[model samples]
Target: MSWSDSFLVLVLALAVEAAFGYPGRLYTRIGHPVTWIGRLIKALDRSFNRETWSAGRRRAAGLLALLVLLAVTGLAARSMEFALAATGPIGFCAIAVLASSLLAQRSLHEHVAAVSTGLREHGIEGGRAAVSMIVGRNPQSLDEAGVSRAAIESLAENFSDGIVAPAFWLGIGGPTGAVLYKAANTADSMIGHRTPRHEAFGWAAARFDDLVNLPASRLTALLIVIAAALNRNASPRAALRALFRDARHHRSPNAGWPEAAMAGALGLRLAGPRIYGNVRVEDRWMGDGRADATAQDIDRALVLYRTACTLLFGLALTIPMLIWLIAS
Candidate 1:
């Protein structure tokens, strides 16, 4: 497909996802496919128990899995394209719907909203439980402020990973690109850790995921800052400063951008010492003004997220129209 065609597909897919979201409860009841994918990876991980496999074999397996996922997604998209050519616009709409199902805009919003609701009703414990699913950190010991910070941070970070990054890839490479990026991200989530078992084996997944997210994460931060300014809660100056100052401090190069921007926009601090699988890492704080974060701050962060998403949808549609005009 041409670049313009891919851009059109992305806009349509984003519209579909933004409108309908992933059928989470239904997908969950039917068995979450992503969870099943993780389980499959876990099962395969057992084969490396020998502790003596050549590095070459591990690398080969990771590459092979990535290639298979990419190929399968490509075939699916090509099949849809063929059907569209033979059938009609309905086939194209079906392809768009199928592509959008793979993105998780609605799912991300629902998870974050659940965290906010839990905080409102059940306090810290409830909030922690809701946030824990999205974050890798141990939530059992988090206080109210910590829980609130986690929720806001997850909202900022996932805006890039779950929404913007996938959309960016889809714009560039169509459904095939979206699927490949999702597969890499899913693999990284499943195995990307500092644990002895996966430290070496997951290097490729982690690095590739970072590469995929690099640009989208920065753009997500910019969009969030713009959204905050539009909401009258934050200035562009603070947003830009926070984005540049703290974005590199986070372990993941891409995640820090949006998280830092959210922190600055909300005038709250995020990221610090946290336990992960019994290991403790002293993370640097992201914002400058305040250490105390509240449930209200979480709500503000959500507003920023919604605003950014809306702005993104507008931009996606406008960019295509502009390109078409220039070409004409």
Candidate 2:
């Protein structure tokens, strides 16, 4: 298929996902792509990662394991594409449906919004329960405001990692590119950590995930800023300012950009010191706004998020048409 066709597929995929997220019945029956990738990563970790091995050896083994996972994932995606190419329009639709599974637009929104609902209806305990589903932080450590901030933080970071990153790769290399990214990202989430067990073995997955996420993170931040401009409740100037001023301070190289933009746009402070498990991590606050975020703030963040997603769809639709026009 042509490059334009591939981009069109991406646009269609995004629309499809936004309209109807992965069916609960379908997931119960076959599980999801990320789960499948997670299983592979788990096996590799068990087989290759050993306490007896030196850090250097474990690192090499981790890199090899990652290569194997990507190779397997890429081959399968390419084979599917090649087979689907023969069926014309039906195949295009099928490819789009499959590709849509890789994105988390609907799921991310639902999960984050649930936190707000929980906070409103059930209070602090309810908010903690809901936010725990999305974030890895210790739920008990959070009060109502912390719960709200955690939900917003998860929404901003996942906006870049879950939605934009996959779509960006899909536009670039079709299903194969997106699938490979999902695999790498899944690996990083499963194994990439600074803990004693994974610090050495997960180094490759961690680094590679960071490398792939670099472009999408920046793009997501810009998208958030533009979305803020369109949102009356949000401040575009502040969003842009926070993007420049505070994004660099967050621990993760890629996560800070979108988080800072979202924080500034909504006039809320985020990140700062937080507990993950028993560990209290000390980090710089993202925005210079109020740290006492409420459920209302989460609603505002959702508005900005939905608008940014719309902007992404517009770009996806426009860019391909522009390329075709230039070629013609």
Candidate 3:
């Protein structure tokens, strides 16, 4: 399929997700496959000791595993495509449904929205619980401001990692690309920490994830800036400036873009001192806005997220239609 056609598929998947939202608990149950995948990854991780394994060997092994996984996923998708071609419209619909399940647009939004609602209804405790699931941080001691910061940061960062990055890969390489990207991301999240146990063993997963996310992260920032402009609260110029100026402050090169853009657009600072597994790292802050964020800021960030998603979906759909029209 052409890039345009793949882009259309991504748009369709996003539309279906936005319109109906995910099935929530049912979707969570359906995530068993991913859970199993994670478990398999963990088992592999345990087999490779960080201190005992050389970085080059670990990278080689990770790449081999990735290739095998990609081949398997590709074969499965191609088989499904062939089966569906013979089965007519029902088969095609099934393919779409299956593909949509891999995209996390609805799930991402739902989780962030829950955080906002929790803060609104049940105060800091509720917000803490919601934030804890989405972020790696010490939530027990967070005040309202900290909770809002964590939730908004997660929403922005995950927009790139969880949603946009997957869509971009799916557009370029179909279901195989999407699945591989998710597996890489999942593996990184599972063992990509800088701690002694993961530093060497997870080097490949983390580095591969960074490479995969490079383009998508920048694209996410652009989309957010455009969305902010549409909303009239955030200037695209300022967003771009903030993205360039502050993105380097974060530890991860890719994550900084979206987070800094969101912070600039919303006029809030993010990424300060936070404990990771009891280690406190004095992280540089992004943006030049309020240090004390409120629940209202989280709501605004959600608005930006929704707008960006809509804008991105529209762009994806339009590209394919334009191409088809020109060809005709």
The candidate that achieves the highest lDDT relative to the unseen native structure: 2
Tens-digit lDDT track for model 2 on 223-302? 99999999899999998888899999999999999999999999999999999999999999999999999999999999
- Model 1 regions more than 4 Å off: 28-50, 54-57, 84-86
Give the TM-scores of the predictions, in the order they appear: 0.91, 0.99, 0.91
- Collision pairs in model 2: none
Q: Kindly provide the TM-score of model 3 when superposed on the true structure, using C-alpha atoms.
A: 0.91
Off by over 4 Å in 2: none
Per-model lDDT: 0.79, 0.96, 0.80
Each prediction's RMSD over C-alphas, in Å, is 2.3, 0.7, 2.2
Counting clashing residue pairs in each candidate, in order, gives 0, 0, 0
Off by over 4 Å in 3: 28-33, 46-56
Name the lDDT of candidate 3: 0.80
Per-residue lDDT, model 1, residue 157, is: 87
Please provide, for model 3 over 10-124, each residue's C-alpha lDDT reduced to its tens digit, 9 standing for 90 to 100. Answer: 7777777677655668746665445756776866766654456677776666666555555665676667656764786676455556567667777788888888889999988
lDDT of 1 by residue, 113-175 (tens): 888889899988889889898888889868888888888888898899988988888788776
Q: What TM-score would you give candidate 1 relative to the actual structure?
A: 0.91
Candidate 1 weakest ten by summed lDDT: 42-51
Residue pairs whose backbone atoms clash in candidate 3: none
Better model by TM-score: candidate 2 vs candidate 3 = 2
Question: What TM-score does candidate 2 get on C-alpha atoms?
Answer: 0.99
Error of 2 at 323 (Å): 1.4
